[model samples]
Target: MTQIATIIGGGVIGGGWAARFLLAGWDVRVFDPDPEAQRKIGEVLDNARAALPGLYDMPMPAEGALSFHDRLEDAVQGASWIQESVPERLDLKHRVYRDIQAVCDPAAVIGSSTSGFKPSQLQEGATRAEQIVVCHPFNPVYLLPLIEVVGTPANAQMVDGVADTLRGIGMFPLLVRKEIDAHIADRFLEAVWREALWLVKDDIATTEEIDEAIRMGFGLRWAQMGLFETFRIAGGEAGMRHFIDQFGPCLSWPWTRLMDVPEMTDALAQKIADQSDAQSGQHSIRELERHRDANLVGMLRTLKARDWGAGAVLKGHDKTLQAAGRIADTLSDIADPARPVLTVDRAVPLDWTDYNGHMNEARYLQAFGDATDRLMQIVGCTPEYIANGGSYFTAETHIRHLDEVRAGARIRIETQVLSGAGKTMHLFHTMYEGDRALATGEHMLIHVSLETRRASVPAPQVAEPLARLAKAHDSLPRPEGAGAAIGKR
Candidate 1:
């Protein structure tokens, strides 16, 4: 059954939530009164389609269907989940919840995207109030993983499934054990914002300087380890306790103006806005989103290599995404004896080039590895299969560089399954820049039981697909590079 999510607003945060669910293969129904809601959400979806999919190496589920409805009732009817992201007015939210209760599925989880309102406040004067929970998400909900979920004790049982649903969409649900005002992350942000307002009001620092203080310094640290962990590391040989002991005395200092609220006169607001515009006026929001996505991708990949933090979550979720799709099988539908599987097609970004301005030698191996992964996906060595402890381990590889590829080149890989049987497999991948062959990689791999870390024949289900693909490729003309050694020739 298709998972249906009803999104009740289409503002920046609401549209972002829509993108997240829609991209995660949930059929989404969006209901917003604004005439411009579609255009706004469409822009958000464009950014999402470009950024979210690139977070994973493997393919995500085919994007789910999206439809817009004018009536709130039309949107919520039959939805498995209803996310209410309307403006944060208590009475308005309660009215929306009452409307949702009338049309929503009894088991459907209704989440309110109110940053200031607690679940108890939202439930006031509302029918079926037990069904409403606070699920506050940050900006660019399509990219950021955190969603602070809070509910009353009466709704405790519903949280487990809600958490699972959030996880399925690549979101990290911090289940608030106790419902509190502003939740956790927002409370920290409020303190920072308060200090920033005071700084600007007192002319102590400009908006640009405040932003610079973050991005140029501790923002990088906070991105990965966060406040407590970063300070713990600062403790050095002593750890968090000692670090706190050293810094604890400063907590009482007037160093921070967090306790005071600065009156935001129009002039101050304009000063901040003008400074922001001066700082980033050159780039549009789309350009910024791309910039943010690129940096995020690099950071996430770094964390992925370390198997730590958000990147680890992203990597783990990639497996779930891979398990959700039939991309490899869909591509393999056209498998034939004379044709190689056209596995990867993408532009060679500037970052892939070496200092000499040519595609690095290692990139050829990387490209071949991607092709091999695609081949594995097609031959039933899928993420799900691997998760269940069945997979192929690369035992050997040989590659020949035929030509150089420059930056911004469009590249493609064609993979030929040379031989595949019970325990062993052979694959040949050829890289091309347009029509010119750039390199060839010949590889030998073995099926293994990941749990035992030993060679094992795959189960019949896996072996069958491998056999079929191998038989289909049996008639392909072998390349001249197939048996060539690394000597002079």
Candidate 2:
């Protein structure tokens, strides 16, 4: 059975967790205190639903249903994974964890999305302290893969295992050895941040210039190779020790005040804001997020084409979701029930008829496949998307031999994405004669990574649309052919 995950809190982070799990085909139950959680999360999901599909080249599997709950205990019942994304208040976190302990299964792993707070502090006095772990993810958890896992010794393995599970879903889970107060990455950021504040305070450079220095210079290099490593390369052919010998003196240079703390004042904020505006002008928070997401997609896609490590991680996550079961099936079965009829206008060509005095069987299949392709394109599947090393390959197909149309029959194949997702998509096609549905075919297609020639998931770019089609056709019950199992290709 596909595991069910429960998310407590339905704000941005919680909504992202919901999207990640839902798109990957895990049933999700979300609980939030705000009365408007459902409406708000729905909007977030809608935006995600549109944006996520373009990330992949293949069809997406069916998305999991999102059930909203007003009660916390109701959401945790039978949940295999419980993610706590409540507001970052120690007492509030403790209270929520205590409540979760009452309903969640003993084996279930509990994760807190606290950026800098230690799990120990958050788990204080909680009944399930042993099961608690901090799962600090960068904003837009659905797109970014970095998830820092920190836990006490009692549930450390469980936390690591959870990290592995997250890795399976295309997340990069960094396991911290000991539960530190601010955690690892944040500590690194703090040092640079402190120095940056000094740079601004000393008027060494404007905020934009500082940002440009990082992004245009070291930041581009850092995407593929991190800090110390880049410095080693700068050290030349003599390698690390020699490089360090030559540049080690710079470490003593009073260039940055790494330990300095910035006082939060209106003047400081204004100075920062003004400098930020000077750098990139002003943009609303929403615009910034769009710009970030667009850049992320572009960079990740570029790296993905090259099969670089970071890109590979993203690709693996996408493909793993695709290779698994049910996701694909749910996505492909999207059909328009209200309008099952399709019309076609074409002249009767003599070559279409066979010796059997009917339209050739091959031609019928060909015509129907063409129609299916068009329908898929209309419903979000496109050739440019499919051809770019990701596409759907038919695994199994059954065409019901119905009443035949003669050589003069002007027909069009009506089709549906029957089901969608990484490896497999279920499609239903019908050959229509004017108003009558003459023949029907149920096809199971597996998305193959053309590079690997193995069943793989479609990249997010491709999966998102199939998900939409699935939602639209969700009310349309499963057809008879849907139950037929697809054989190995």
Tens-digit lDDT string for candidate 1 (1-489): 899999998998889999999988899999999999999999889777766765665656667999999888889889989999998788888788888898789888999888988898888876776788899998879878889999997688888889999999998899988888898889999999999988877888888899999999999899888899999999998999999899999998889878878888898899888888998989998788767765776676677767778877888897786565433454345535357887776556444667897889887888899889888877677798899999998888899989988754667788888888879888988989778999999888999998899999998877887788788888888877886642224
Any runs in candidate 1 off by more than 4 Å, and if so which?
Answer: 326-364, 373-414, 419-426, 430-472, 477-488
Top candidate when judged by TM-score against the true structure: 1
C-alpha local distance difference test of each model: 0.83, 0.72
Question: Which residue pairs in candidate 1 collide?
Answer: none
| lDDT of residue 240 for candidate 2 | 88
TM-score of each: 0.79, 0.65
* Candidate 2 lDDT by residue in tens digits, 407-486: 43545565555566556677777777777867777777777888999988777766776666655666665665554544
